[model samples]
Target: MKVLVIGATGYAGHRIATALRRRGHDVTGLTRDLAGAGARALAAAEIRPVAGELADPAGYREHLWDADVVVHTAMDYADPAGSDRALIAELVAAPRHLVYTTGISLHGRVDTPELDEESPSSPDNPLHFRYQLERELIASGLPHTIVRPAFLYGHDSRTSQLGRWFAAPRFVGDKDKRWSFVHVDDLAEAYVRIVERADAPLGDIFVIGEENPPPALEVFTAAFRAAGHAGEVTVHPISPEEWLEQAADQDERVNSAKARRELGWTPRHAGPIAGMATYYAAWQAANA
Candidate 1:
């Protein structure tokens, strides 16, 4: 299959592009700056690059023209409205499947341990605009699917809550505040599978992640110790209000069983807890 991935330079997009290539698909990664486009990563995956701006239709149209499927891995997209509308128009005109990458944060501040798809939608999340628009478009009868993935972690992933533990004096969350994460490769597989089966009456929303969600502090402390941080790991429990204020503005948890059952998608990474040590080792090496 031929596919075009927007934001292929990002942490998630890069891994997704590689997963598609490994599965024998012809992948073109769209990037604005080819110079910093993780050339080494793309080459390793055998995926080609298409330099262009995602917010501009003309810039992306050339690359989207003949793609069998367009998996949009872009996030905090500069022009989410315009880019989504334009791409939806393009994909609808050609009748190709389009996958929009959303986050669990769309569900709003998670004051609890877990949230499934049945959880009531949050009308108050400040980031709800784009997700709402994308949901509206998917319901507009266009060939589209919404993929809401949780904290993404994997190869060449420059950012991970676990990765932060490599640095000492890391702010560990309450010892039992749980969060979910998905491997980038697994997310890419889910995207590709959905695109391939586009004709099978696909779903409108799919969350991707491992079944296990670990306590935030435990995960980070393990990473800290693994990274050879000599200082004793500390757990600082913050109130929900304080958490919302201190933590980076993003979602905390997501459910992935829908995708697992429908698309046969299952994350290969050992969820967040098991992967902490590995992430710490990688982080330490990279930083050293």
Candidate 2:
């Protein structure tokens, strides 16, 4: 299968492109620059890079015309509408198997419990325009599967929840504040499996993630230990009335039973704490 992957430079997009290529699918990375980070990270696959941004659908026509499936994982923080509109337009014309990425944050930070695909989504997060773009796409009724993943963590991911604590030594309220997350590799495979299943229903929504997410305090404390520090870690518990001030409130916790049954997907790694020591060791070697 010839696959077209947009935002091939992002955390999820890069992983999906690599996984698809390894599965023997010919991949074309659609991005602003073939020589940029996303393309560079995919050096192992040596995928062909199309030097066009998603905001310019006309530029992606040649690449889109040749794809058997399309996975869009890119985001334009500055102008999400433009990029999203472009991608939707392209999909409307060529409605092959399509997968779009969204985050659990759209549902706001839920700390009391974890949320699933069926859980009520806030969709009114104060972040930016991308959530609005997601709303538009869902209503468009294009043949596609929308994947909403919890916080995604993996090696070398600077923006991940774990990475932030490791790189910066700060603690949010209540270290035991629980949350769910999916590893980058696992989330990548979920998209691949979704695209492979031609018999799956249209307008499908799958929450791709591991079932047992860890608590914030415990994971960060272990990370500090891995960094050779034993400072008295604090677990600042956010007040019930102050949940909105917290970073992530995805308390309902995400589940992947549907993906596992329908897409044949499973996560390889457990929660981040289980492998904190191992990841820290690798971090030392890579940063050294």
For lDDT, the strongest prediction is 2
Regions more than 4 Å wrong, model 1:
76-82, 110-113, 167-169, 172-175, 232-253
lDDT of 2 by residue, 185-240 (tens): 88888887887876778788888877866665677788888878877876555465
TM-score of each: 0.83, 0.86
Model 2, runs deviating above 4 Å: 109-112, 127-132, 235-247, 250-252, 286-288
Candidate 1 residue lDDT tens string, 23-119 = 7889988877666637556765788877787766566676787787788877544676776777676666667667778767666655655666655
What's the distance in Å from true for residue 29, model 1? 0.7
- Superposition error at 25 for model 2 (Å): 0.6
Task: Tell me which residue pairs clash in candidate 1.
Answer: none
Best candidate, TM-score: 2
